[model samples]
Target: MLIVTGYVQVEPTELAQFCNEFSALATATRRRSGNLSYSAAVDDPQDGRLLVVEQWEDQASLSAHLEAADTVAFVDRWRGRMLGNIEKYDASNKRGLMD
Candidate 1:
């Protein structure tokens, strides 16, 4: 299994639009067979930070998701709107046990 954590910072004024689109893509991501989950949350009230907790069956499965239309679109469109940085992390099956 693979666990991917993604962090995105948005402009305070642009957070609402960012969340609207991200939430839709996350919903579709969770519907995929290889997807264990695709959940996201903001850091705090009025904060522009967003964190995504994603789980997939394996590396190949996650790669497939990377090619998915929704995923691709989200990457292309939202990337420019993002603030400072976007962070990513991967955890293998054994490491994921702690989750």
Candidate 2:
């Protein structure tokens, strides 16, 4: 499985607009093939900080999602509206406590 996590910071005044755009993108993303889950949360509303979490079936699925037109468009639309970097992690569902 593939896991992605990150946080973005936007201007407090633009939180609502940013969230609207993010919601549209997230909804579309969740419908894509191979998508396991996609979500975003407000970490600090006063600071306009938001956290994102995503899970994919594999690297290929994640890559396809990244290359999707909607994904590209969303990035372009929100490029200057937020600040943060996303990181990805490779994981396996081993039958263990740590898993």
Candidate 3:
């Protein structure tokens, strides 16, 4: 499985715009064949910070999802205004295979 944990910040006034697109993207992604789980949360009202948690069946699934049309639209539409300081993470070494 693949896990992605990350967060981003945007202008408070743009929250609705971000949520609209993000929610749509999340909905579409969750319905995909290889998507196991997906979620995006707003942690602070004043900060306008958004956090996303996602799980995929594997790296291939994640890559495929990234290439999906909806995802492409989301990125092309809001690549600049929707995110600030986004971070991505995974558990590649969790099973100790790298050790």
Q: Highest lDDT among the candidates is held by which one? A: 2
RMSD of 3: 4.1
lDDT (10s digit) by residue, model 1, range 25-67: 9888888878988887898536688777887887788888899
Kindly indicate the candidate among 2 and 3 with the higher TM-score.
2
Estimated TM-score for each candidate: 0.79, 0.89, 0.81
Q: Per-residue lDDT for 58 in model 2?
A: 89
Give the per-residue lDDT digits (tens) of candidate 3, residues 13-97.
Answer: 8887888888888888888887888998998758789888888878888989888888888788777776655444565555555
Query: Any runs in candidate 1 off by more than 4 Å, and if so which?
Result: 45-47, 83-99
lDDT of each: 0.78, 0.90, 0.80
- How many clashing residue pairs are found in candidate 1? 0
Top model number, TM-score: 2
- Across residues 1-99, which tens digit of lDDT does each residue of candidate 2 receive? 889999989999999998999899999999988899999999999999999999998888999999999989988887887798789998875367875
TM-score of 1: 0.79
